[model samples]
Each structure stands twice: as structure tokens, then as C-alpha cells.
Target chain A: MKNFFVIIVLCLFISLQAFAGLHVVTTTTELAAIATEMGGVHAEVKSLIKGSQDPHYIEPKPSYASILNKADLFIAMGLSLEIGWVPSLLTQSRNAKIQRGHEGFIEPYQGIRILEIPSGVVDRSGGDIHPEGNPHYLMDPRNGVIVAKNIAQKMAELDPAHGDSYQKNYEIFAETMNHKIGEWQRVLSKHRGLKVVTHHQTFSYFADWLGVRVLDRIENKPGIPPSPGHMVDLIKLIKKESVPLVLLENYYDPKPSQKLAGETGVKVLTLPVSVNGVETVTTYAGLFDYIVTQIVGAQ
Target chain B: MFTARLMVVLFCLCLLFSPTLVLAKKKIPDQSSEGQVLLWKFNQTGNKALIPDISLIGIVSGAYFRDDPATVQWPNPTRTGFNLQAAELGIQSVVDPYIRADVFIHMLEDGLEVEEAFITTLTLPLNLQIRAGKFRARLGRENTQHLDQKHFADYSRLRRYFLGNEGLTDLGAELSVLLPVSWFSELSFDFMQGRNDVSFDSPRKQDFLYVGHWANSFNLTTNLTMQVGVSGAFGNNVTVRKLTQIYAGDLYLRWRPHERRGFKWETEYYYRSLEGAVATAKEGGVTTSMVYQFARRFEAGARFDAIGFPEDAFSQYQVSPILTFVATEFFRLRGQYNFLHTDGAGKKQHEAFLQLMFNMGPHGAHSF
Candidate 1:
């Protein structure tokens, strides 16, 4: 009888150990993909916002709080990208471990080079300006390597038993990403310093990375819809600049870009900015692959 | 003495901006010296950093009424002309690592009123959170929300009749717990001073209002979500030396495909039982609304409210259609038309309102 009781207790302990993996929750799909890759089999990762959704204006949902309540590590592409929603959800989650300034809470932008940090007095006249900097730094593949390292380091700190595994995963991801960055840059070497019109400032880092020049944006200011007067001005500018392509994210309205294309005879390349933004773009590498293929195809 | 106070204020301001100045001087110009120049320019402007986030919201409305009644409810435009409805000042900040505070002061025609002043505990064990001071109780969907957060231009007649014109707000302490479940679920309890004359009023110290609410949310689909809550409140009716009880249920369904477009449907039902010396009077009502964002900046919604249900003691019904245009995150323009009918007087009234609201400050995130 004593032996049977001891065996039962041993089985319960083993089962509990088997189920004890870290739960990671992120604010965007790109972070979810990176965290999944870095955490590997030791973590369960989920994203609050889908790839097709706009990260700027998410309505904080109660279900998201539930997901966050159970999180062991909470990651966000901070720089106020989620200023409108994530703060309230974090408070509602009632999980102290994942609050701001905690070991379990990670803002990956701290280690990366931020772009578009405004100077002087900033206000809403710029149409939803991000004061800290552009939160879209992950568009540069090098920044993705930095973010992966940050996530792996945090995960290893939280779950020290799998520290080596997380570090190994980060190394593999970094090497592959470095190699792919080279390949992508080589493929687009001919189009270096290419002049393009974009829908929003979302592609600043991407343009910087590949040596593309954004002459002007369809929307005069960020987050504002393109007005007819602005479109007329943009048409003249595109003609004068000899801009050949207009790059727009998949989530934005395509009508304005289509109009620009109709007027200027320039190609419109609508691409997804996040992983799983489209059916074919399921991985981080796949997102860049699709974007490069589209831009090259437009050429 | 005034000079001394001014000097103290100046000292505080300097204390606030000194860190930014120090950081600016220490920052090394990396790739962009332009950013550093801008930082210095900003500091020269004396933008203080340590102060709480301050925002002001102004609401003005123009109303026209047919068969103008002698009086309208509080916060509704009584006369058929332009009116300065309210100007709200909100001050919010995280006090420290463990707590945050929010204060809202409303300037009405009467005077300034402290609408809500509360402190919330950010860290607690067992998934528990405590909020103390005066605040709106989590009774139902609409009671806990501010007027600016509502879809309509005015409060629902049902809420005005049952929970008083100001809704269930009073000096209270709340304890809420997030349940460990597969979906979102929360349970909250409140202890409030019984000061609302419409429902509960007690002279005894121990006759405090007690409220309990259980809220749950489910993601019906990838784009669809639903939240439902049931709440109950009990207190003493000192006038009759008896007990008063209120029960309510609320449902909210939202389908948001993206940021630019969405649809929401909300309904709330309320019931109250008042014990009098002669007998017990039971009253109930329900209000439901649907709003659809068909465009990036425009949305249309309609609401129906009916009172005196389950017990035909009195009858009142109101229907309102509202259209809103959001120029930006800071500005909004709205138009609403209301049709109201009451059975006692057999009177029908029609009213129209045009409202403009604008805010300036750091954007505050609201709960789901």
C-alpha cells in the first residue's frame, strides 16, 4: 500500500512538470512569430492583434486581458505603438509579474536603433505622431535579430532550466536572418536608391535598409486619409521625380494608390508588413520574401 | 507670502525640467544631430516632465424641441437653444509602482463638480485589485462609464429613472478579482455610501449600499466578441425603514474587422424593488442600442429605451437615432434625434441635438 501511494505521488509530480512551460503574450503577430521561434518548445506564445489588423488602434478587448492574465512574459513593440490599448489591458490583467518595469515585461525597442524621433514641440497636427520614435523598426531585418535576442534573453531569465535551449535558438535565428539579409540585399542591388512613393511612414526602416528613397507619401500626414488636393500635388511630384512605384501596406485602403497608379502609370505594390498578414506569408522570413518579390516584380 | 508661493512653484518647475536638461547635455549625437538640437529647443521651451497627464474635454450642443416640455432631465438640454453642456478636466498618473490615480472634474452650469476621484492598486495577490475613494460603481455597462464614452448625446431615460440622473456614482471602495478561466471573467464588489435619493437614502452609518457584479467575455469568432454581466445592489430606504434592492443585466457584442470599421450592439435591463410602509413597489426597464462604423470616420447608431416592464405601473418609451463624424482622435461631431412618449400624460415630444466635443492631451486608454 505504501509503495502504491508513493508511485501515485511521483506520477502527479511528473505530470505537473510536463505542463509547466512559460506562456508568452505579445501585442503584434510579428513579435509572436519571433517569440515562438526563440522560445521554441519551452513556451506557448500568442498575439493580441492579428497580422491583418492595425496595431495603432486596437480596441482593448476583455478576452485579451484573460490571455494576458496568464502570461509569464509580455512583450510589445513599444514606442507607443500600442499606447491606445495595451496599457489598460495590462492593468486589467491583474498579473503583477508582467506589469511595466518588471523582468517578465519586455519592450524590444530598447536595444534597436529607433527612427523618426521627432524634434521640438510635437502635437496632433502631424496626425498621430509617435513621440518616442517609429515603432516599425522590425521592418529592418537587423532589428529583428536584436528583438529575437532580447526575447530569448528574457525567456531564459524567466525559465532558467531552458536557458541553453533559448540561447541556441536565438543563435540559429540570428545566423539565418543575417544570411537572408545578404541574399535580399544582393537581389535588390540593382534597385538601390530607387525612388518610391509610400502610403504611410511605416516603411521608413525598410526603405533605409534597402537604399530606397521615399519621395513623398500619399497621405500628407501620418494616419490621415489622402485628400484630393494632396493627391494632385503628389501626382505632380511623382511625375517630376520619375517615381516608378507606390508601396502600400495591405491593411490600408488601396483606392488612393490605385488612383495614383491610374494617373501616373506607376506600379502599386501592396504588401503585408507583419507575419501571417496574408495566407502565404506565415513566417518572419516569408513576410520579407513576399515584400521583396513584390517590389522586384513591380520593377 | 504670494511671492513665496510663486517661488515654490518655480522651484518645483525647475526640479521637473532639470532631468531633461541633464539628459540632453549628456546625450551623444550619433547619426542625427538634428534630434539633439530639437531636444535642446524643447527644453528651452520649459516643457515640464514630472507633472501628471492633464486633458480638457469640452462639449457644446444645440438643441431644438417640439412641444417643449416644462423641464427636461439633468444634463439634457432643457431650453431649445445652444448650451455649453460640460467641460471636463481629467488628471491621471501612476503614483508609484503599486498604485495609480485618476481625477475628473466637470464644470457644469451650476459649478465645478468632482465626478470621479479614485486610486487603483496595480499589484495584489490572488489576482485581486482594490480601488478606493469616490467612483462610479460597476453596476452595469453604462453606469460605470463617463458621458464622453457613451454613443448617445444624452443619458438613457431608463438610467435616469432608476439610478438617478448621475447614475450609480458615490464615495465607495471596490474589490475586484479576475477569475482563472478559459475566457475573460471578473467578479467585483463595492461598498458605497447610500446617498442617491432616487433609489437609496439612509441616515444610519451602517446602512451602506452593497453591490456585486460578475462580468464575462467570450470571443465568438475571430472578428466577433461578446460580453455579458449581471449585477445586484442592496441598501436601506431609511424613509420607510425598509430595504431596497436593484438587479441588472447587460450584454455587449462587437464585431471589429479592423481599426477602420466595426459594429457594436449593447443592451441593458434593470429591475428595482422598493419596500414601502404600505407595500412593495417593483419597477423595471430595458435599453438596447446598435452602432455601426460603416466608414473610417463616420458611424451611425440607434437606441430604444422602455420603462415600466413586468409590472405596468408606468409607461415611457424613447427612440433615438444618432450619427457621428470623427474628424480625428481629438475631435468629434455628432447629431441625434429623439422621439419620446409617456402614457400618464399621453404626451409625445421630439427633440434634436447637434453636439461638438474635442479633447487635448495624452490619450487615455479605456477598458474593454
Candidate 2:
């Protein structure tokens, strides 16, 4: 009986070591960054997409399959953002543990405010538009706080042994974001209700948060490249709105945007949408810093 | 009698539990407790008349086989065989917000053989999706659908000679993904084990069986809204002692210089090399097609295809015109006429078809 008890104690020790922490896999660098902060040393977080790469397009490498094949939790920006590769990878990776509807598949946006919900039918002809609205909600600092809180809550639920640590990390992130929000409000205070035009619909949430006025979009529609006729009309619209800036994401084709900017004599602000969008912007703080500096500098 | 017995059993069960479900529905008004069931209907009809020779007017029913449409006679429709081509049944609803699955089964009688029975998976995200069981191989754009579903009938001679008159399908799995660059592009990769659609279960040399191999293809349809992609596959036929390497690509552009009225121009080119005594050397081909759709309901298109084969004395070219009419949302009809010319020698083949198309609920492959 004593020997059996000893064996049981040893098994418990081994299981504790084995279950030391959960293995979490996030689809994008943004989620990975936040998860790293929340999980701290208790969990190992791996992001499938490089920070500089667009989260929308990930060439699923063999390594991703291997990671997904063993993940304890899978997190992503849903709303069809990762619609391109997430589903098939789940199936091909044969990781039923984190497949959709499984407790481990965390969309993260479940309770957050969703912007741009389309009221009518959406089709491909509309140019790569998301019917659910602009999914780049993480751009606004307020949304960032909500996302971090949710991530912390999820981490705590998933790892109650280290729940306190997760909560402490969440507080740190939330405090940091709240302070930055004040700084951003001051920086953006001058640009409130500032009229602007964008190359795409990427900045809807950012503009909403900053109280910036969007006169029109350069693409005419979300995914379609603006036609020559559309460009001519936009030039007129920009002049009419007296838009001061034509904002473009770093990765978009700049030819049309530049041409329109030149035609309207509006400053073209090429903003980095995410941390490490370029080699220069590599952290969450850096992402906000870059956007603020650029918009301020451009104005 | 067995079906009647089963129906009676189901009826009694419904009677016993129908009220309970109603009570549940009232209690959980959003219908979350009752769950959700969706239904859809679709069909298509049209006419085919070629000048100076052959023409026919017919209607094919069942785009998606919900219930079997009465079969139509053949030869009288198209010498190739059965006409009233497709009927389908589809159902899909989210088990919950995070989980959803759809099932589609199609039934078709080609007068010669029962042609279609298949299922597809449409719920993969990030453009990554896998289709298993039985479905069409992603060969050529035209080969992927039924005639009425196609912008035209009378596929290229190369498609006929190599892929066969019917498109390929068998027990297999396919994976597709979209690169997130905002470039509007997609890659569909497939791996399947199936014989050619033409000759089923035919015996061949070990090299031929080996050559009847698995294919890995990369298909990229650009977001220019034009589809321009190149895909290649290597095949090994152990029974016939032959290895085949094939590369094919198509450039497709749908330009609506004007909305509601537009022109679609598509060109497909292929190069195939089969390593064997009889199949040595390289064979290359190209097919260019142009279509004009009027009022979003009527379509007129034509294509020119050319190919070179060793067994043949020389290269061959075939030109054909395609016409289609949309009768309703779920139903469409189409017709085609082909003119084959081999090194100045010409022969004409005309064919017509009627197809009922039921688009049903949206079950779509991951868009690039």
C-alpha cells in the first residue's frame, strides 16, 4: 500500500511537469504579442504569421501544420479575415482538439463591439469586402484594452493555476494602453474631425477612434483597384471635400494613390498598420507610435 | 412497404414530439433550441440551333438533385448521350455559431451511365479548405462544372484528348488557401487517387498504372478579378513504363466595361511531356475564348483551340460558338457548336444541351 502511494505521488509529480503550461498558437503577430504578455512564462505562444506579413495571406508552411497538430489552443481574428487558410489547415493538420467549435478555437471577438456590419447582400464584385465590416478593429487603442482583457480572462480560465499571474499581466497591458490612449488623444486632438481619404478601408476603426472625418475611399470599393474613371471622380471628390491627407497602408500598390494625391495636392500618409509592419515598427507600442508620428508629421 | 413502415414510424415520433419542439421553440424564441434548417431551389433552360446543319431545343432539369427530375432521352438531345443533366439536394445550417457543415448530393443520368453523385466541403477559413469523398478534380475552369453551369459546352480538343470528354472525379482530398497580401489571389492544391473519367477500371501495363498516378497542382486566380494561373503535375505509370509531366495555365478576364453588360476573355495553354517510347517528346497547346453577355441573361461566346500529338500527323485546331440563356435563378440552359480543322481538313460537330440548375444554398469553394 505504501509503494502504491509512492507510485501515485511520482505520477502526480510527472503530470505536473508535463502540464506545466498550455501550448497556444495564434494566427497573427498582434495576437501573439498580446498572448505573450498575458501568458508570461506559464505558456508558450507561437504566431503563424510574421508581423510584417499581411494577416490575411499566410502561405501555410509545413511548420504551421506541425505546430497546429500539437496546439492546446488556437486564436485568430475571425470575421473571415483568415478565411483563406485557417479551415483547411485545421482539417489537414488533423488537430480535432482545436477545430472550430472546440473549446480551444478562440475567435477573441465574440463579445467585443463589431464595426461596419453590412446590412445587405455582399458579393465578390464588391472587391474583397468583408460583409461583417472592417475586421481591423485592433487598430483603436480602446479595442486593444478590450482585446487584452478578453485574452487575460481566457488565459485565466484555461490555466487557473496561474490565473493571478495572467490577471496581473492584463492589468499591466490595460494600464499601459490606457496611458497611451491619453497621449494619443492629446496627439490626435488637433486632428479631430480632420478630413481624409484612404487607399482602402483599412483605417475605418482608426478613423472612428481618432474622430477623423473620411471624405471618401480611393479604391471606389474595398478590393477593386480604382479605375481611371473612378480615379478622376475621386480626385474631384477629394478636392470638393478639401481632404488634407490620402492615407495608404504600406503594402498597397501606391501608383493610383500617389497619382490621386498629386492630383488633389493632398499629403499621402503611408502608415504602418501593425507593429513590425516594417523593420522599424516591431512592437505594439511601436505600431501606435508610428501611426501617431506619421499622421502628426503629415499634417 | 419498408419505406411506408419507416414513414409511419417517423410520423408517430413527430406526433409524439412535435408539441415538445414547439414548446421549446416558444421558450427559446431565437430558435437556438429548435436549431436552424435552410432550403433552396434552382434550375436553367435554353435552345441550341447551328446554321446549315444541326439544331435542337430541349430542357434539362435538376441543377441540384433535391428530388429526381424525370430523365430525358438521348441522341435526340446530343449524340454524346444524356441531356436533362443534373438534379441536386443540399442542406446546411450552423450546429452553432462556431461550427457549420453542408452536404450536397447530385444525381445525373447520361443515358449511358448514372453520371453524378458527389459531396463538397465549403467551410474552411483563411482560404484553406479540404474536400474529400468524390468530386470533380480542379482541371480546367470549363471542366469543373456541368454544361449549363459552364459559359460554353464543347471543351477544347486537348481537354477531350487528355482529360477526356467528361471531367475527372474520384475518391480524393483537396486543399486550398489564400495568401493574405490583399492581392486578391488564391491557391487550390489537390491530391487524389482516381482513374481518368473516360475509361473506368481498364487494364493497362504496370507503367500505365504507375502513370495513372497522384497529381499536385497549384492554381492561382488573381484578384485582378481575372484568373491567370499556371499549374503542373507529374505522373508515373508503372504498368506502361511511362512518366508524364504536365504544365497548364489559363488567363481569364471578366471585364464589365459596363455593369449589366460585359465581355469575358479567357485563354488556356498547356504543355505535356510523357516519358516513354510511344509518348516521347513534348506536346504544347493553347485555347483562347471570348464571351459577350447581354443584359446579364444572354451569353454568346466562341473559342479556338490547337494542339500537337505524336500519334497524329500534325497539329489540330477547333473553333466553337457557345450560347446560353438564364431562365431563372436556379435554372439555366446552354448550347454549343464545334468546328474541327486538322491541318486544313475540316469537320463540323454540333451539340445541344438543356440543364436544370439548382444553386441551392451557397456552397462555394474558398475564393482566391
Candidate 3:
């Protein structure tokens, strides 16, 4: 019993190891990348998920609570994108600061216009629709500017001592992105009216931004696997529309898309949808560069 | 009888495969040229209605079993027909920044009973959490879970013998600490007001019994995880002597790959010794359960149970096979077959069970 008490006290002391800066936990690698750019030396950022995995499905793990317990701020793409995992982790973290309604929790898509919000009664029948809106808004680089600003402001509030530093870093990130966006727009300018197809609905924001026409999705619904009938219809639509590219992400199985490509003879382009999704796309800026280059090269 | 059973199996197989044919022509969502849909913006101003996260879980199970030679065990659900098993209405909310409250009401044939009502401290110092209210005794790994939360529809013979019909739940307070060791380890100590007949008969007794548990889990690989734990509880029994004690050990191994169905294997062993009350002797048992998620929404599992009563030199063994279908995220159906045999003057019994479980409202994912 004496030794037990000793272990408990020692554990508590280790858990309380104070950090010199704000500690941030983001739901995805892209958000963590944005936070890191804005936070710089003033904060520490950790993402709950890796870049290659699908954000739609995350298995709950105890290590999530262990890391979340130490977070001074939490950032996530709301709109039910993280509905499967983050809510449970917040409840078990035991850190009141990161819970909902707390100042430390930040939803990056608060002011952005969300896409794919259903017009009528929505359920799984519509194929895994987000009750709020489509949460894959980060595909648009302009939204990355908004995400970075939010992180900077949140970090400033939590650690006022470095508020000025965070803002300076935010300004630099915004300017860099502003220049890159113009270049990206020029690259995609010629392909505005071209019809595109994808394995999932994740390209909504990207297609909307570039004015590219997304004709069809291989999967009938969000979580459901594509049926033979659905696949037949999709192939017909792609062939009829002359869609040059059928995009797929790394997180999903490529066999279905490969089959679609084989049947329709349309070129398939697998893009790294998130930061660190591929070795080359290590940063947020590189994500856009890789995606745009792939789309253009495929054409 | 063989033809009759084969007919049932064929019918079930048809029922199962027919859904796949329907899925091939499922409801395909229409394309929206304008994909933007923005609704009311969520404000942090607290203007929105505070809705308590409420959930209702209902389980209806029916079973058929042939009588064993000596006698059926306690609360084993021996009736070989359909029955309205149980339902639970649960309400939970964060009471304040300092605590959260969870309450569950079990609806039974008699009326409604408070299954568990507890408040957990959210903001305690030193990685410490305090839970105060009535909870299942953390004696064995499975004993802490309520009936509706189980993977199997029917209770095993060991659990039926040790935990009784309702399982060993008591009014209790628990304090758990996240240990500082490198991995995921939690140590919890519980003190509870004993229950009637199983351990102590008086609800008014102020003498609190003690139960302790230590659980540690680690990822064996990226997809596999192994968790091991030990539990001990001591109190008074109405049997013969004045004291009753239980010691338990449990292990769970699961392999859950990303974006795929997984498998889980669980084993628990327990030893209970009664002193000076009814029988001043020791009894022991072991239960092992395994589940393989072979399809997207279907799983098959089996359990083996062996238990020895303190009063008798004979022992009982049972084997059960269960097939389950998750119709949706909130609803499930299971069919189970069990074979029970006894050693030393006990007859064999064959049983079958069918169960349906459904849930409504918000219930967050449980701990791993």
C-alpha cells in the first residue's frame, strides 16, 4: 500500500509536466500543419489522425484521451466530419478545457460556407451525409487561409504572451497562400468546364472552387460500397460526358476505381488528399501543388 | 429433427442473402450541380437549447433449452421460448465544468428500476477521477457491463452462477487514477453498499465493501491490441459464513484494422471463497468468448464456460455458438445455440436463442 501511494504520487507529478507554450490537438494532419504554421515557436501541435487515412472512420483508442488530456486547445473540422471518434475522445479526456463550450475548443469551419447540406430529411439513406455540411472544405486552398487565421487567434487568446508572434506568423502564411492561390487558379483556369468524376464526394469544395464539373461518384452513398448497377450508371455517365480524370484518394481501396477505369477507358488520377498523404506532399502548400499537377498531367 | 433443423438453416440463409440482392439496387443519392448547403451557424453564445444527451436501448430475447439432469442454474433463462428480455433508458449530460451525470433506468416486468445513476468528476487533480453512484461491481471484466451491452444474447453458466440473474450491481462510489507508467494503465478502487442475497441482505448497511481493479492495454501492432487486468472484491455473504471474497483476472485481444472488419477474443477467470456463512469453501470458474467479424455487418462468435460450485464436487461446462447481424448502427439481431453438459451425475441440455437489440438517441462510443 505504501509503494502504491508512492507510484500514484509520482505518476501525477509526471502528468503535470508544464509546457512553455500552448499545446494544440487537431483532428487531422492538415489542420495540425496549419496550426504549426501559425503557432510557430509559441505552440505545440499534434494531430489525432494521420494524412493517409480516411477522416470519416476512426477507431476509438485510449491513447487519444491520454494525449487530449494534455491539450490546452483543440481544433477540428466540425460539420459532423469527425462524428465517429472526436466526440467520444472529448468526453473521456477529463480535461475540461478542451470540452465543448470551452474557449479552448475551436471548429475551423465556423464561418466558411459548407457544401452538400441536404435539402430534406437526411439520414444514412442519402449515403453518410454530414448533418451540418460537407466537411472536406480544406480541399480549397482559400479556406486554408481562414483555417490558419482561426488557429492564430485561438493560440493568441490562450497564450497572450505570444499573441503578436502568432499574428505575424499568420500574416506570412496568408500572404504565401494568397500568391499560391492565384498561381493555382491560373493552372486550373483552362479546365473550368471539363467534367470530372471521383470515387467519393470529397472533391466538392475543390470542384466548386475551380468551377470544374463533377459528373458522378462511384460510390452510391457516402459509406456504402458501390453496387453493380451504380457502377454501370457511373461508367455510362463518365463515358457520355467524356470525363478526362477519375480521382481517388489514398485512404480507400483502388480496385473499384481501377475497375471503373478499365471499363470506361477514362484515365484515373489518385491524388494525395491530405498533408503527408504522399512523401512529396509534406506540407499544406505541397498538397495543392501535387493535386493540381496530377490533374493537369492526367489531362 | 435433422431435416427440420436443416430447413431452418436454409431459410435463414435465404433471409440473409436476400438483403444483398436488395443492396445491389440501393437508394443512390442524386447529384447536385450546386453542392453548397449552409444552415444556421452554430454560435458559442449559449443561445441554443441545452438538450440532455438521451438514449434508449431495448433488448428482446427468446430462448429454448432442454432441462439438465441435476437442475438448471440460477438466472440462466431456461425457458425454451420467446420472452421480452429487457430495456434501458439512459440520460447523460455534463452537469457543469466540474462533473458529468449518467443515469440508466431498466424497465422490467415488475416496473422500472434504477440500473445505474452516477456522477463522474471531470476536473479532478492528479489524473484522478471520482465516480459516485450505483454501478456494477468491478469484480470481473464482464460483470461491470450491463445486460444490453453484452456481445452475446444469453448469459453464460459461470456468470449465471456467480453474478445472479441481474448480475452483481450495487450502490457504489469509485475513484480511478490514470497511472503514470508509460502505457495505458488505470487503477480504480470502489466502495459500495452491498446488495441483498448475493452478498449482504441489507440495503441500509453502512459497512461498505471494497473492490479494486487494475487494467493495462497496449497495441501489439498497428491493428492488434492486448489488454490484461486483475480484480478483487470482498464482502459479506448470506450463505453460511460472515465473509465472501472474489479474485479475478481477465484478458482481451483484438485486431481492428482501419476500414475493415476485425476480431476480438476475451477470457476471464474467477475464484470465489465463502467463509463461515453457508458454505465455508471455495468455488472457481472460467469463461472464454471469441468473435470474428467476417463481413461488413455480420459477425460470428462462440463462448465456452466451465464452473464448479463450492457446495458440490461436480462441475458444469457449456459451449455456445452465436451469429449476429448489425442491421444498422443502432439495431442488431443474433441467433445462438448452446450445449450444456455436467460432470458427475448431470445430464446434457441443448438450447437455442434469438435476440433483437435496438437503440435510439445519443450514446457515445465506449472506451476501448
Candidate 4:
């Protein structure tokens, strides 16, 4: 029986070679880039979330299921960032490797620090909210590096023949990121003390890293839309302070930010919070550089 | 034969055409945080093929025994030979950061050998929805495709009769939104109008009818969910007003000490006031069912339902015992025995049934 099993496995391996190159599926473009950077030529990576689309409200397209069905590995920013959509999508993949609890189901947060861990039971009372703090851990460069390493390790395990190549590529990528981080820090330091207002509380990590003071959010509550009274209060507060720029995400409807900026005489600078925020900012490094250039240029 | 072949051809076309629609433009999270896409579903491969988030399809098929073979129950059970119980396909995709659309197509028994189809789209941004075609109303949980997706093989007999298997589906439109509430609970209200399924004494062949349904649910710390809802419909026909007050409510709770396998208890009560129609009086019924899946691949369950019509002297009851075996990840074998007892009719009946279920893909997620 053991010999028979070995023969079947050998036949399967021969059939698998026809389907060689590793297929990587990711939930977001940022993670896709990391997998590509780590896997190099050994794997082809695809992102489920398009940079121009909302990560939270992605409708599982039939096309995504087809991609996942054949993919060898799946990576995501876990902690419910893709919560409402991922679970149902993954169930369609039928690949045991990419299923939850499998090594292929890689969550980069396993090695990084998590922020905004809610102390109480977090429900959807405040709109469709994630109970597990914020799932946007990728905003921080350090978290990005850690996630890249996780992807590299998983790729090495799946393809041992290319394990050495993956490690070398990861090391080079880390060193290159380290050098760029220093330059970004220097550029951001000049605007460290600047006070900024944002539409939502999505810039907690970026603000912490730059030491920028978040005066007030344009949104009245976490998920609540800005009311007339709240906007009036925000306008009063902005005029009272020496604020220069009001930060707004690229995906947000700019009318509200523009209206508030117009009232307070504040410049509404639409910033890319993640990769693909603009055609030029297509990678993680490009995203940070774009944000830094905008903030410092405003000065 | 042509229609059957047509359905198969459409299903295959959907499967083949899906792959060509690729994500050409690089996805930027910012562009999608606020979106305006209509409807979508992601299909994977194998039994898990499709978006895991909120997509589901179910079917229910059974035999109905009548007292007199001469008098046919207009819609209850006319003729049966492996009928197309239900054909539902839906997609609840998040289009942007803050918006998602819940859309579905329901094709079920409309009239004599007739199948109906409709689509419903629920948008979250404005707490409103735009519906087109035929869809089930929010009258009661059982009225919707609730029993069809059950882990057990049988449902309460009361649900089968008054709720009419396909429960309140017609060519119409409805708008509903969940309201903000305190604690772990949610509230929602619905109002709809169009082609109603309930028959009335209307001289006009087709008349616009109004329907209203309200639902509230609470979740406790002990992994228990309790929901209550009330629904009513009104038609313009002078005689139809007599059948206006149709109300129903259901309570369901499932306790899972462990995920994938657990125990569930469900109950439902239905009341219909048909002024001078068949048994033209008031009729109410209640059903209670208990299910337990203690081990992987095995399950055992039972149910008891009783009904009381104003014209009838005593209530009718039904008890069912269900057993299911999961032989593989994609298939399940279920067998059930239904014991029917009617006080007025001296006939005590029993039916033994077997059902083979092949899940097409990933099971859709239920709303929390």
C-alpha cells in the first residue's frame, strides 16, 4: 500500500511540473508587490484588491475565485481588513494550502506590532466597524518590512529549490528599504510639528512616525458623516489655529474636504494613504515618498 | 428540453466569461473607499468556488399528501415529480469602502408550471435599496429561503402550508435599512409594492398592493441569536381588504461551543386572517425544532409544530426525526421521518425520505 501511494505521488508530481511557476494571490496590491519582490522570478503574484477599489467593500468577483482556485499561495492583511469579503472568497478557492490554518494563508501581522486594540466588545453600532482595532497595519514602514519577511519565508518553504534565491532577494530588498526609510525620515522631520486635519482617523501610524499633531478629524465620529454643526465647529477651530493643510484621502469624495477647506481658508491636500493612490505611486516606497513630498512641499 | 439546455448553457457561459474580466488598472485603496459599482461575485474553484463573504443558494423538495385526491390545494401541492423547488443566485459585494450591494435572482414555482425571476439591490450609503423583478418579502424568516438552507432535512409542517413553500414572492420592489440601536441589537423597517403573491377578490387582473415588515434582533454573550418580526399586506380590491392582515414571526437560536459544529433551537409562529376565504377565519401556528451536530460528519435533530385555525376545533401537529451524514466535503446524505397527526382527521400519517445534497461551492455567510 505504501509503495502504491508513492507511485501515485510520483505521477502527480510529473503532472504538476506542467503547472510549474508558483502562483501567488494577495488581498491588496501592497502585499502583491511584497510577494513579487520576495519571490522574484520564481512566482507570479496577483492582488484581489485593486488600488482604485475599496478594500473593505470588495465584491468577490467570479474572476477572483478562478484565480484563487489555481493559486499555490494566498496572502492577506488579516485582522478583518478584508473580513466581510475574504472568508467567503477563500471558501471558493478549494485549495487546502490557502485555507485558514494552512501555511499558505499568510497573515503578515504575525510578526509585527498591532495598534488600536479595542478594550471593549467592538460591535457594528458605529457603522460597519472592525472590532479588532484597525486592520491598516501596512501604513507603517516597519510593519511593511516585517510582512515582506513573512512572505519571503513562506515562499522559501514552498519552493526550497529557490529558497536561497528568495533569501538573497529579501535581504537586498530590506537593505534598500532601510536606506530609503532614513531619507524619508529626514524629509518628514521638517514638518514634524505641523498640525493637520483629516477626513477619517486613517493616519494614526503616519502621524505617530512624523510626530505631527492631529488637531481634529473632519468626521464627527468614527464612521459617522460630518454634520452641519460639526463642520461649523471644525471651521471655527481651524481659523483659531495656525493650520496650513487639511489632509484628505485620495479615495474620499473631495467635495466635503474642499467645502471645509474653502470655509476655513485651509488648503485641502489630497494624500495617497496606500499604494496605487496615484498612477505614479505604484509601490510602497513610492507611496511614502509621495506623502512626504506633498507635506514638505506645502511648507 | 430546450429550456433545460438553455439554463445549462447560461451557467457554463457565466463560468467561462468570468476569467477575461481582469483587474487591468492597478488597484489603489483610495479610489475604492467610496464606490459606485452595481453587483458582483468572486468565483474560486472546487466546492469553495465563489466569493465567501455573502453569497448563497438553496433548494427544498418534498411530497405533500392531501385528504381528498379530488380537491386540489390551489398552490400547496398540485402535482409533484421532482419539482424545481428553488433556483436562487445572489451577490453581496462591497463596491467601495463604505458601500455594498446585495443582489439576487429568484426563480421558483410562480403558478401552474410557471417559474418567476427577480433581482434586489441593497445599498448601504443612503440606507435605501432599489429592487427590480421578483423577490421574497421580509414578512417572516421562514417565508424567505430560511428552511431550504437548513442543516436538517425537514421543516415545520406549519411553515410548509401557510407560508406556501415559496412564501410571499412576487414581481415587486422593497426598501429597508438597519437602524442604529443600543447594546448588541439591530432594527430594520421595510415597505414594498407591486405584484403580490396572495390572492384577493380583485376585479382588476393586476393591481398594485402594499406590504410592510419590521424586524429586530438581539445577540447575547452566550452565542445566542434571537429575532422577531411582524409583516402585513393590503390590496386595493374591495374583498381583498378582508385578507389584509397577514402576520408572522420566528425565533431562532444556535449555540456553537465550537465552530463548524454545534446545536441549534428554532421556533416560528404564523397567523393569517383571511376574512371570508377558505376557512376564511383566523389561523395561527407555532413550531419548535432542535438540532445537534456533536461530531464531524454526523448530525441528529428533531422538530415539533402545531397549528390552530379558528374554524377547526383542535390543533394539528407534526413531529420529525432527522439524521444526516457528511461523506465528503462536497456532499451530504440526509434521511428524515415525518409523523403527521391531525385531530379532526382520524388519519395518522408518516413519511420516510432520503435527500442527497451536493453543495456547488462555498456556503454564503449569514448576517450577524
User: Which 10 consecutive residues of model 1 chain A have the lowest summed lDDT?
Assistant: A11-20
- Of the true interface contacts, each candidate retains a share of 0.48, 0.01, 0.28, 0.02
Chain B TM-score of all predictions, in order?
0.86, 0.61, 0.81, 0.67
Question: Candidate 2 chain B, which ten residues in sequence have the lowest lDDT sum?
Answer: B35-44
Candidate 3 lDDT, B1-368, residue by residue in tens: 34334434643554344322353355432323232212112522363336677788888777777863244332234466655666788988778656788888887655788888988766555566778788777776788777665778877677677767677777867777777655677888777776746545543354456788998878788778888999988777664337778889999888876564789898998888767534467888999999998876789999999987343565888899999997666788999888888786456778888888988776655566
CA shift of A289, model 2, Å: 0.8
> How much is B22 displaced in model 2, in angstroms?
32
Q: Write the per-residue lDDT of candidate 1 for residues B72-173, one digit (tens) a residue.
A: 555656668887777889998777656788899988887898888999876666677778889998888889877788888888988988887788889977
For every candidate, C-alpha RMSD to the true structure in Å: 8.7, 14.6, 12.6, 22.5
Q: Write the per-residue lDDT of candidate 3 for residues A150-236, one digit (tens) a residue.
A: 778778767888889998999999999999999999999998877888888888899999998888887768777788898889888
List candidate 1 stretches off by more than 4 Å: A1-18, B1-49, B67-74
Summarize candidate 2's per-residue lDDT along B6-98 as a digit string, tens digits.
434644553354322343343322323231110000011233111111112233532222222233322113334444543444433333322
Docking quality band of candidate 4, CAPRI definitions: incorrect
- DockQ ranking, best first: 1, 3, 2, 4
> Cα deviation in Å at residue A125, candidate 3?
4.0
Model with the higher DockQ, candidate 3 or 4 = 3
Q: On residues B1-368, what C-alpha lDDT tens digit does candidate 4 reach at each position?
A: 34334434643553344321231232422413432111111213466443424333444445443332243332232333343444455554534322234455544566332223333321122223334445566666665654335655544567665545445566554544333222222223333343443432354554455566666555553345455666665554336434445667667665654323667787777776655534455677888888898665688999887888443445788888889886543356777777778786777866665655544333444332
Measured by TM-score, the strongest candidate is 1
Looking at model 3 chain B, which ten-residue stretch has the lowest summed lDDT? B31-40
